[model samples]
Target: MAAFRIGEAAQLLGVSADTVRRWVDGGRLPAARDEHGHRVITGTDLAAFARSLAESPSLAGSSARNRLRGIVTAIVKDRVMAQVDIQAGPYRVVSLMSREAVDEMDLRVGSLAVAVIKSTAVVVEKP
Candidate 1:
């Protein structure tokens, strides 16, 4: 039964506050006012909306279920290995790979990339 303010919902959804306001105004997102007259969205509603927004098809032929589209923010490389950082919405994904693979993919700062994640274990916490 957790609730989030408009700003918090926007941050969680990786959108501007104004955009979230518009969604509420346009009836695309359901919201209610708190005692202080601040608009709040329930965590359940937000999760449904997030799922709807993620309905788009992922990369063709990719089996990974988690895909985060983002821009490359940094790249640190040594003779053998490289670290690539991608800013995907409100999340930052970091990957360590071989320098040869980096060169083969030509990944660089400002490059658009998707972080495909497939794991058996994931950690979730309540805030």
Candidate 2:
């Protein structure tokens, strides 16, 4: 059974360690003291809590499983294409699309957008 310390859990969840501590303190997330007397979250419990946090009613019909809601941080447009940057939680998602599509969507800095990612091959790495 794998367990994560508060700092590790926070890094995985893209939040600060203090936020994880608060969640544990407020009973939003379950934790147990390890043998060393430090709080730790079981991997199963952490997965459930992460799922709960990711549920979004607005994205109910999306076919893509990976959806990140974020504000548009930057947009660069040329004559034919545009590049958009979004800060979603602790992740930065970038997209390049046709300028016509960008104009039709009225995408601009500070606009709210959702990045729907559908990838067949994704590489996962551990540090």
Candidate 3:
């Protein structure tokens, strides 16, 4: 039942604000005008749109469903490996991948990207 502004939607989608505007303008995403005459996206609409995007084969792999969209905070590259860090709201997700993959994805600091996480097991520790 929550509503989000264009900027907030962009941050959640790991895209630029202009991209969200374009989506709204192009009718790809649904939005409504607020009292301030600003575009507002409902959480339901945004989630559906995100699901569509995530289902795309080219954008995110089909196996990974837990997608956290955010901006790249840091990237450390070595000869064959690279460590990428993303800040997704209050969560920070890090992943290590091949240098080639990193370069192919054009992952750099400040770049908008999504961290697709597919984990099989999660361990819990008592306090």
Candidate 4:
């Protein structure tokens, strides 16, 4: 792919040229100057930076704040509470002693369950 100029990159990212320059200066976005002092943006560098930004804390926190969806596999109802086995991902998460919440969700085995974990923390990983 052809490299974009600073202005073009700013337009692509929906930001001002100065913001893009700031990112470059902050090492979020990497750029170099030609002999004529023109800022040249590399497509490779842009892609790498985009991947990094996607895994950034801001984006992750916003995503967690967005929503968390899952399913209920089992529910252990007690005298006053219930333990719910929720399958949210590659793992199963359990929420114990939440009778009212379980009832509010109408939770049962094989029922769809959605858990909203609002957090400012961001989790990052590599495959």
Return whichever of 1 and 3 wins on lDDT: 1
The TM-score of predicted model 2 comes to: 0.77
* Candidate with more favorable, higher lDDT: 1 or 4: 1
Candidate 3 residue pairs in backbone clash: none
Give the TM-score ranking, best first.
Answer: 1, 2, 3, 4
How many collisions between residues are there in candidate 4? 0
Candidate 4 Cα outliers beyond 4 Å, as residue runs: 56-127
Residue-wise lDDT of candidate 4 within 51-73, one digit each (tens)?
66547465554545433346888
Model 3 alpha-carbon drift over 4 Å, by segment: 59-62, 66-92, 96-116, 121-127
Q: Score every model by TM-score.
A: 0.84, 0.77, 0.59, 0.41
Candidate 2 lDDT score at position 105: 96
- Say which prediction, candidate 1 or candidate 2, comes out ahead on TM-score: 1
lDDT of 2 by residue, 19-64 (tens): 9999999999999999999999999999999999888686678767
* Per-candidate alpha-carbon RMSD to the true structure: 2.0, 2.4, 6.1, 11.7
Rank candidates by lDDT, best first: 2, 1, 3, 4
Candidate with maximal TM-score? 1
lDDT of 4: 0.73
